[model samples]
Target: MSDMSEAPKLDDALGSLPGSRNFRLLADIPVRMSVEVGSTSLKLAEVMDLAEGSIVELDRQSDELLDIMVNGTLIAKGEVVTVNNRYGIRIVEVATAEARMAGVERRG
Candidate 1:
């Protein structure tokens, strides 16, 4: 019979695993998420001329829900809202599990 007592223990091998448990969570982790809304070539002068209640049309149509994203990845879509004097967005739709996984795979 052969002796197999020299192998390393499983817990010892995995004791140094990396994790995010101690990470600080931020609400807007992806600050550039809304950058890909698709409107291009609008000059700063033109942008500055815009005023409150002036509707600056976006690339998305009225029927299309705006893509809410994080770290440049689409996570959800929703309509804009104002609650308690604070701007908020209501999530009308969320990306599917498979779709989210695919994005992760692409990034990796």
Candidate 2:
């Protein structure tokens, strides 16, 4: 078996692995996390006609869970929640490791 303790250094803005495969090596490093409510694509003319009170329709239904993304990758699905007036997410489902890797591979 290959010793991950001497794992090759992966260079990127995300941070280096310090020649080890220990998961804790990355536990403290922060990442950009975001919740995607929905998405829509509009033509240039439609976008130019925006007003003060414009309503843009999205592709997902209201009842559907929102996508939870980290570093531009979809990692989970969750619903909205509120705690002490602050909005948060109630995670409903998490993507399998293979699926998450697939997303990362596609972007890479």
Candidate 3:
């Protein structure tokens, strides 16, 4: 790891580069991700009553889209789907840049 003082500053690194305004550099930027959606709770009785094939219902409705998150930020909304017998989520709508950036800044 390098100390902040020893590392190139953001302005020095990007400002001095050629084609700095191109967005290609950011196309594949990697980031940590996490997600959260509506939740529900079960009592001790319910917990104990659960069986091997039991299903606990979530707070969200079947038609509702789940939130897709990146680095704990809401980036998009997606509906659950099935592809090749595997479960997946298809993004239905994307959050705005301002919203995503606000979330990232808030966490930082």
Candidate 4:
């Protein structure tokens, strides 16, 4: 008969694993999220002449999807929607898992 007592035992407790516990800790951490509709550059004089009703065109078209940023990194694209008279974004596309992990690595 072969002796198998020398091998290490695998841990079954979730909290005993450093990676699992660390991720659980990070799950509670808050991150800032923002939605970008569009942006435009205007001269100082042009910006100063703006009035309440003045309209300034943006770089993106009105029908274009908005960008969803997490801690300043683009993670998804969405569109604006109204819910109960409040403005919100409906996510249309999300970044791949690899891309999202890369973004987190870059931020860290």
How displaced is residue 41 in candidate 1, in Å?
5.0
**Residue 36, model 3: Cα distance from true site in angstroms:** 3.9
Per-residue CA lDDT of candidate 4, range 1-108, in tens?
133476444444445677976667676679999998889999999999999999988899888899998998889999987877999888899988788789888878
Worst 10 residues of 2 by lDDT: 8-17
TM-score of each: 0.48, 0.77, 0.56, 0.69
Q: Which ten residues in a row have the lowest lDDT in candidate 3?
A: 1-10
Strongest candidate by lDDT: 2
lDDT, residue 34, candidate 4:
98
Give Cα distance to truth, residue 101, candidate 3, Å.
Answer: 1.2
Residue-by-residue lDDT tens digits, candidate 2, 16-93: 545445655765789999999999999999999999999999999999999999988889999998877999888899
Each candidate: RMSD: 14.4, 9.7, 11.0, 12.9
Tens digits of per-residue lDDT for model 1 on 71-106? 656888887778779877677889897876787788
lDDT of 4 at 49: 100
Considering every candidate listed, which one attains the maximal TM-score?
A: 2
Question: What root-mean-square deviation over C-alphas does model 4 reach?
Answer: 12.9
lDDT of 2 at 18: 57
Candidate 2: residue 20 Cα off by (Å): 8.3
